[model samples]
Target: MSVVLAGGGSAGHVTPLLALADCLRRRDPATRITVLGTAEGLEARLVPARGYELVQLPKVPMPRRPGPDLLRIGGRLREAVRAAGAALDAAEADVVVGFGGYVCPPAYLAARRRGTPIVIHEANPLPGLANRLGARLTPYVATTFPHTPLPHAVQTGVPLRHEISDLARADDAERLARRLLAREHFGLDLDRTTVLVTGGSLGAQRLNDTFGEAAPDLRAAGAQVLHVSGTGKQVEVRQSAGGAGDDVPPYVVVPYVDAMEQAYAAADLVVCRAGANTVCELATVGLPAAYVPLPVGNGEQRLNAEPVVAAGGGLLVDDADCTAGWVREVLVPLLQDAAALRAMGEAAARFVVPDADERLADLVEAAVEGRRVPS
Candidate 1:
């Protein structure tokens, strides 16, 4: 079957699109997959890197307020829809799967015009404008969060990369072996209670500064830290007492980590932003986290972390409240409590639907075949 997937702007959208594409390909080697995305978005590189044909579309962002830009949106949308329809025709798409982003609106409209089957996967708890519009067009809607207000939405969870999904299913011994190997790879002590601090690819300055300031305190609490400060973002960490001594827990800081699966494997706990992808990934891998939601957008990040935190799988902290003092008082003690960490990790693993890629793929196939789409 020929399928065209749409999403962009960030990893949260593109990552799931790629995961679903990979799952579809694995299920049927002959399936043709085309990705519709913006030339300027992360999909420009990621989609092509994943060996899928990427059709670049003009980004048509909906103006939130009445302005001169809003006046021109109609014309811009028309142009984008025209381009999106042409791409759909070129691919001979039997179905259009949309993950919410600026690119999805045009793709959904174009697919509807062509009488193509539509399937949408929303990764955020709060639906974006693009996905909300897409939901009106199709009944086959899949959601990462159960509470997302989309009609006919199936709670399929977020589609994760195979490496992470595989990690989720690993046995205890195998997981421990992987943990040891990952720790060795990251130059971390195998026995240390390791905490990983990441703020996604671009890194959050607040996280870098606050976590960096708290590093010495974390080490004093007998925890090692692996801090990914994002590309070109420096985190100044002061070591405890003797700089590289065995008594001082290691506080390794790097700008970026290409192998995030390895980092995930090496971590005992994670301190990061609460993007839907991050939340789902942590839960799927049975890792406990201290989620600091980004204090912007439609407050979707906080919503994303809430269910996991409520399930006793994680902790939620507001961005403004995630100060160094908070980290010292809360995270340091949490790290020392090994039993609590293990229980939280177990809860996390039980809370997520780990096979979302396969489930969404099933929905797509059902949509194409005119069969009943599973909830």
Candidate 2:
């Protein structure tokens, strides 16, 4: 089977596309997979590294207001569609799968014009413009969260890397062993309750500042913090924590966590932004979190964490209130309660759909065969 997967702009869009590609390869090593992206998107780097053919198109963002760019939008979109059409034809694509980003709409339109099957996977509870458009073209729509107001949307969960999925779905003994191993590998205290603080690749300034201020309190409560302050942002956090100590400090400040699975394993609780992928991964691994939604855009980040938080798996703190005071009053007490933590973790695990990648792959195969399910 020949498949063309589309998405890009951020890791949220690209990661799932790679996961789907991995699933397609595992299902049939001979299946040809091509990824559609733009030169500006992260997929330009990530897709090629994953060993998939990447077709680059011009980035065409939807303008929110009237401007000179509005006139140029039509020309740019047409160019992107034409490029995508050529890529699809060249790949002999049986199905075009989109994860919903800047590149998806043109890819969807191109595939639709060619009468090729289109499958869309929406990672957020709030559907983006591209996936919403794709959903109108086909009933084969999959979503990470339930009730994501889109046409024929099925709750298939988010496609995660095999390593993460397997670890998340592991049995009691295996999961425990892996977690222990991860802590040892990271040189983290096995006895201490570990809290992971991350704000994403470039990092969130608010998270870094607030967490740095709260680090001492976190340590006083017998909890160790692993704060990933993004690239080049760790120095400020270290300075805030009284510079780098000779001994293993209660709070470890790192620029980035390249091996995120290890960080996840070493963490008993998480404090981070509520990106779609982050919420899904946390739920999958049964980790409780204090999610601070990014205070920007269409408020989609808050929407992403709503279900998990509602299900008693996590807490949603508004961006404005995610300060040191809030952490001292709420987070510290929560960490102190071991029973509550376990219960929340159980709730998170139960809320997750373990086999989303395989299930979505089945949907892709069906689409390739011209068999369209009602959702």
Candidate 3:
């Protein structure tokens, strides 16, 4: 079987598509998988490196307001749709799976015109423009969150990395052993509970500033910090926490944690942004979180964190107010309470769907066969 996946722009879109692609290839090594993305999107680099074919399309981002850009978008979209059709023909895709992004809409349309099966996966609680449009074109729709409003949308949890999915389903004894081993290997203070803070690959300056400010309080509460303060922000963040004179600093700051699985294993609690993938990974790894949702556009970040918070697995913090005082007052106390942390971790582990990759692969197979998928 041949499959075409459409998505790219950020890791949020690309990662899930890759996860699904990996699942398909594993299930049947003979399966041909092609990724449709714009030359400008992240998929150009990621898809090829993953050993999948990448077909580039002209990016046609829809304008938000009335402007000359809006007028030019129609012509660009037509050309993109043509390009997508040509790619699909070249690959002879039996089914097109879309993980919503700018590249998806045109590809979805092209697949529909060719009478190829279409499957749409929306990772955000609030559906993006591309997936929203794609959902109308196909009844085979899946979402990471249950509340996403779409026609025939089924709750098939976000497909995740194999490492995270395995960790999620591991026995408690095994999980604990790995966590302890990871902490020791990282030279983390075993005496203090670990608090992992990250702002993803590029890092978030807001997290750096506030978390740094609250380092003293966190340490006083017997919690040690593992802060991935983005790339260039580390120097200033470390200096702000307290320079070289600071005695045995409680916070271990790094630009990035190359092995995120290890970081997740070492964490008792996490403090970070509430991206779709991040939320799923945190829940899968069974770690309680204090989510500071990005205070920007459509408020999707807050919505993404709501389910986990509701399940008693995490807490949501407003971006502007995620300051030292808030961390000291709320997060510090939670970290110090071992019982509460354990309960939260249990709740998180219970809430995740450990076989999301397999489950979504089933959906793709169903779509290809023109069978109705259970909602």
Candidate 4:
């Protein structure tokens, strides 16, 4: 059967859909999967790389302020619907599964008109505007959080990569993976601890700046560092703090790290944004993290980090208060105490709900195949 896996514009939305698609393909190798995204969405880069066909649509991220932007969004949505219709017709997709983003609203609507089943997956604890709009078009809605308020929304934890699901136990796997990946990928000293820091695919200026400032101190403490620098900041970070270690580059900074499995495997601790996907992935990998939520829009990112923080697996750092000094002070002690880090990892692991991808894949398949999902 054909599945139009619709999601994009952000890594959070696209990541889960990819996980679900991967699970569905494993369940049935004959499953024809196509991704719906715009030229600008991360899917344009990620989907095709994964060997899935991408149906490029014209989509604009919903504007925070409504005015000409809203009008432009409306026009784009109409165009998006038309583009999705063409994609659906060309691919002969039987069902379209939307992993909640701006692209979802139009794609879900097109699927509805075609009498195709539409399944919406909302990854955030709180619903976004696209999911809210898409919810009106379909009765099959799934959520990551248990208490989401959307009607017809069932609690199905966010789907993560198979690599994460297959992670071994705390000491056996994390340590083993960490040692191998750190030495191989970053060429850092395996004798000392390693900290992996990322700001997502788009990267974060604040994170890079803070970490870059602490490069000398981080290296002096015998901690190998792998940092992800935002697009424009890569040159700056490399030119400034990358030359600390004569033999191994003390700190390795890159625009992005595609191999998340390796990164998670290599890290003793993670320091980054508290995006919904990051939260789920951290739990899946069972890593200790110092979370700094992006200070855009509302405090949704901080809210998402709540479950992890409360569980004692992660520390919440408000972006406004996250400074190089604060990060150094908090992480230096945690890194030194291996027992505390292990305890935090165990606590984070408690939040990971296994078989999330399989559950979501099963639900989507059943809905499209006209089989009732398990009650």
Instruction: Estimate, for each residue in 1-375, the C-alpha lDDT of model 4 and write its tens digit.
Output: 999988898889989989999998998999999898888888899999999998888766775444686676677778888888888988898888988777787787788889988888988777777777778876778888777778887777899877666663446855686568656776666666888888998898888878877766676566778887766666244333455446543577777777787778878899989888999899878899999999986667887889889999999988877776886788787888999999998899898767788788877877887776543
**Better structure of 1 and 3 per lDDT:** 1
Task: Give the poorly placed runs of model 4, Cα more than 4 Å off.
Answer: 64-72, 168-178, 235-249, 371-375
The residue-by-residue lDDT of candidate 1 on 124-222, one tens digit each, is 988887888889998899999888899999999899999898888899899999999998988888999999999997899999999888888898888
Q: Is candidate 3 or candidate 4 better by lDDT?
A: 3
The list of candidate 2 runs beyond 4 A from truth reads: 64-71, 238-248
Model 1 ranges with Cα > 4 A deviation: 64-71, 241-246
State the lDDT of candidate 3 residue by residue for 1-375, as single tens digits: 999999998778888898899998999999999999878776888889889999988888964334687577788889999999999999999999999778887899999899999999989988877887888888899989888898898889999877777777788898888888888877786656899998876788889999877777776676788888887885333333444353443577888775588889889999999999999999988899999988888899999888889999989999998988998899888887999998998787778866777888999999998899965
- Model 2 poorest 10 in a row by lDDT: 235-244
TM-score of each: 0.96, 0.93, 0.91, 0.91
Residue 132 lDDT in candidate 3: 79
Q: Compare the candidates by TM-score and give the number of the best one.
A: 1
For all predictions, the C-alpha RMSD in Å is 1.7, 2.3, 2.5, 2.8
The lDDT per prediction is 0.91, 0.86, 0.85, 0.81
For candidate 2, write residues 234-308 as lDDT tens digits: 534423354445443467778877568788888899999999998998899999999999999888999999889
The numbered model that scores best in lDDT is: 1
